[model samples]
Target: MVVSSVEKPIAKQPHASRLYRELAPAYEAVWPILARKRIRAAIGNLELDAGHRLLEVGVGTGMSLDSYPQSIDITGVDLSTEMLAQAQRLVEEERWSNVRLLPMNAEELLFDDSSFDVVTSFHVISVVSDPRRMMREVVRVCKPGGKILIVNHFRSNNSWIARMVDSAGAVTRRLGWRTDLNLHEITADFPLRVERCYKTSPTSLFTILTATKLDA
Candidate 1:
């Protein structure tokens, strides 16, 4: 049940890549408290084993690299050259021979269909210009029965909070992501089967979602 890309109008997120470029150097320092543990938790939830080929979209600074087992093969992609530079440095510093970093768009992946055993992204869905398109690409490249994982903050179900977030869109755009993205809307049309969805972090502001690609 592979989903095919369709022509549709996707609202442009013009500042997203530049925002990450500007924040690349200070990103880890600024969000360490909120990000570190949650990232480890997301990677842990993947339950990757040796020889697995993992593709990480939006691999900013490669902060989650160290958490993965050394035996797994990893290819991480990001739109920001600066962020990929930081990730490259980390890969070298850690001498992670199993890892590779590239600058690419998640919405338009370059890989062949069913190329990887696992595909994951962290805090990235909200930042991409077209979350649904990016997700379709994720599913398209993942092998049948492969796992897909995503961790990010979604639009609150509470009406008041959701309205407030939606109203603050202009302000949040400068920060490189939307504050009111609907998780269900993003995943609704995809062919994958949802495995689980749960909130994480101290404030429970973010969610860890896991799904498996249906076997063809």
Candidate 2:
């Protein structure tokens, strides 16, 4: 998308970057328990083969890095360099030769079109300045017939539950993420098909969605 220098200020998430940068270590400590199992399960469901190219958007602290099969090539990118540093240390300590981590914005990925066989993003869509832009980038970089997997909390179809969450949108927005992002709206124009939508557990707020890009 080539975000301009002038627009960069608005594009860069001051509050979100600061919060995640300072708390990168703490995020490593706390987020895994809540997400590891689900992320692993969803990636597992993809049944990725050896040599498949995979890109993970917003790969904070490399939380889901270990879950991906070592046989596949993995590229993980995030806007927070501090978080990337944390993820880098893990990549080094684990000696994951198949994994590469970089600092990049989710909404403006630098790769060429159809660059990867699979794409993933977890708990990150709502944090970007433009969720739909991020999604568009995801679709652009994925190869035809490739796969896309996203795990996030979107506004519920259930009016009562959605209303309760929407009421908190102002607060969450200030805190760095929005609570009222609609999944359908964000995904409607993409050339992807939703194959499955599920939760780690019945009560979990996050939805793990799997989709496939239509063949060229």
TM-score of each: 0.89, 0.90
- Which pairs in model 2 have colliding backbones? none
Best by TM-score: 2
lDDT of 2 by residue, 1-216 (tens): 222332233256656777888888778888898888988888889979999999999999998998888999999988888998998999999999999887788888878889999999999998888889999999999999999999999888889888988888888787688888888978897898999988888767788999998864
lDDT of each: 0.84, 0.86
How well does candidate 1 match the true structure, expressed as C-alpha RMSD? 4.9
What's the lDDT of the predicted structure labeled candidate 1?
0.84
Q: Pick the lDDT winner.
A: 2
